[model samples]
Target: MKKAVGIDLGGTYIKAGLVDENGKIIKKQQFPTLAEKNDREIVLTQIEKSIEFAFEDNIEGIGVGTPGVVDDEGIVYEAPNLPCWDKINLKKIFEEKFKKKVVVENDVNTIAWGEYLFGAGKGSKTMICITLGTGLGGGIVKDGKLLRGGKYSAVEIGHIPIDYKGPKCKCGNIGCIERFVGRDYIVERAIKGIREGKKTKIYELVNGDLDKITPKTISDAYNLGDEFAESIWIDVGICLGAMFSGLVNLLNPDTIIIGGGISQAGKILFDTIEKTIKERAMKILSRDLKVVPAGLGIDAGIVSAGALIFQE
Candidate 1:
């Protein structure tokens, strides 16, 4: 029944929860991040407020999952959509404020570790977990430990280039896997298809308002037997699978876990990725590989933040 406070820091909202050793949330709450204030102190106070909402006496520690590059000392760097977020020692600040041990890590990395311990990847020795949302984010659990770069949490899997000469990514990379399958990119594909005179239920789903289209729209269209929407999801799966093939060859992980909103496309995306990886990756390396959705569901962020502290 050991418990800890978990904080999931995002651009617009902060989610906090009390999680026990079994990865079950005992209590949880949410608060606005107020990052638009463009003041570091304001955002910091928001995080503190979230912690206070979830903290209790004699907890093991507080774990915060944040969006950024986290260094070994729990210092965050280059965090987007936050004011003056460069090189802030969140661990030190939280520890000082609460007199408890603090663990800070990149949000996706926290999710990866959480899955390794309590989710779909519970028994896997090595796992690759990716969240496909507004952007792509990923983390790796290798050899029963969270993989880290030399100093920072370097697993920025979204930025990994799938095509060196393809479309430019927001990160200034050419043909990043995310550039192909990220939320905006996926929506862009649908728009492009519609403009090219491809008839799809996507247009009907949004009443011909292309700007109103989203990945969910496409998913709904696909559910209604729209071939165009199906093709879009398949293409995205291929893009992701192509990138994962290289990773499979290099890391030989046993499981690849896909999460986030877009992953709800269900069987089509997962099956395509699995098929593409099997055909493209080394047969021996991929023969036992499994592509599965994340197990943590809606409260993944909160539970995974707590898992960071519970991880051995």
Candidate 2:
């Protein structure tokens, strides 16, 4: 059985695993990113160590899921999360260091591919994987192939403009859906509500420490029937669904798999998203589309990365 090594490089940690063609992770290891070291060489070394630990031997290739724009040649153009990585040639470094074939792709793309091949989208011919977290990232797969547009950055649904003059996005755009529905936006709205003395359970949950308020905290507050938090999630769902409506019209995918930290909100998130999409999307386009949550969870990156090398 041929095996592959998969690495998901993030700002805070590096997760690597040995995975088989069946999407089964045989071995796994993790380590801190140590990005502040300010040297790409050091970061690459740590990554190699994690890969080595995960795969003792017999790895056909290594696949890396990075947090930024990556060219088909496996070069990272920019990684906002990891400031140390800027236009780094990740594929060359890994291949030279380990003498193994390497494949590098954007982290969200990896996750989307993983889901399409082995998770919720296993049997779908066309699918869109949208991850809602710190920022919204997406990948679109058409007929089992990942779509890389002109700049190898297609399906960047998060940046799709919803409002012409809304809030500013980190991408320097105005009214991008990401600015309104991203994890930070969700938490920010909740914190604002609390600060305004909205009599809600969120105040009790965070104990006045607004800094500790996270998307998860807001989700928990929503589950506890906090009206303000619930409203925030509803708005997030509506925004996401509205964005997806355009995708539904364009691709008419069999599934749209929603993933990432905020997805853990479960029905509170999905219900609203589904409702909004149904109300907004074209009837024919949405009739058969399934909007589902991702199954791979945190392992999505590693599994998807491995698929880059292992999938037929």
Candidate 3:
């Protein structure tokens, strides 16, 4: 079978995998990206090492998924989290060394493409794929194709304004969906509640350490019958639903896939979002659109990167 090498580069970790042309991952490995503590050369070295771990003589091509604004030719203009990844010609660098066809794209787009070709979105013609983690990232597939705009920076669904008068966003906007539902935002909400003396299981789990009140702690609290934790998750769900309601009214996608670590809150989180979408979205769109969690689990990054080649 034809083989390929795929890389998923993130702020915290870099995952590399060997995949068959059929979209099945044959082998996978990871390394700490240390994107912040390291310079461009160091990070590139880490990537090189990961590729070495997964490399085989017969690999046909290489595909990389980066969390940044990547041009069609695999140049990264900027990575939001990794400060050193500015204006890097990742494709040229890797191809010069590996002598293989290399393609690079935004991480979210890779995830969406993986789903489109091999996972939950396999049959959908139009879909919205979201990953809720340190921040929200999204990719839109319209009419069975990735919607890359003129500058390869379209469908950044997370930056959409949810509350015009709310907090300032990193992108210089006010009250983006990420501002409401991102992991840091969620933790901040929990911290605010703790400071205000709103008691929950989160405090016990974190042992009164406010900084330790993570999303998992909150989800755990909700699972353990803490009303305060439930409220927090529900609030984020409402924000997500409200935002998607607007998306449904505008783009009318057939499926919406939610992934990333934060989405593991399971029923408590999903139920509220689904309820809000059904109540607020266009009737036809809500009735027809299927909103669900991702199917690729932790393998998404590698599989999705591999998909950039197969789907092309």
Which candidate's TM-score is highest?
1
Q: Who is ahead in TM-score, 1 or 2? A: 1
Q: What is the C-alpha lDDT of each candidate?
A: 0.94, 0.86, 0.88
Q: Clash totals for all models, in order?
A: 0, 0, 0
Ranked candidates, highest TM-score first: 1, 2, 3
Over 262-293, each residue of candidate 1 has an lDDT whose tens digit, in order, gives: 99989999999999999999999999999999
Those runs of model 3 whose alpha carbons end farther than 4 Å from true positions after fitting are none
Worst 10 residues of 1 by lDDT: 78-87
- Tens-digit lDDT track of model 2 for 234-266: 888898888889888888888989988888988
Task: Name the better of 2 and 3 by lDDT.
Answer: 3
Q: List the residue pairs that clash in candidate 3.
A: none
Stronger candidate by lDDT (1 vs 3): 1
Judging by lDDT against the true structure, name the best candidate.
1
Query: Tens digit of lDDT per residue, candidate 3, span 197-280?
Result: 997889999999887778999998998999999999999999999999999898888899999999998887788888999999
The list of candidate 1 runs beyond 4 A from truth reads none
For candidate 3, report its TM-score.
0.95
lDDT of 1 at 170: 79
Clashing residue pairs in candidate 2 are: none
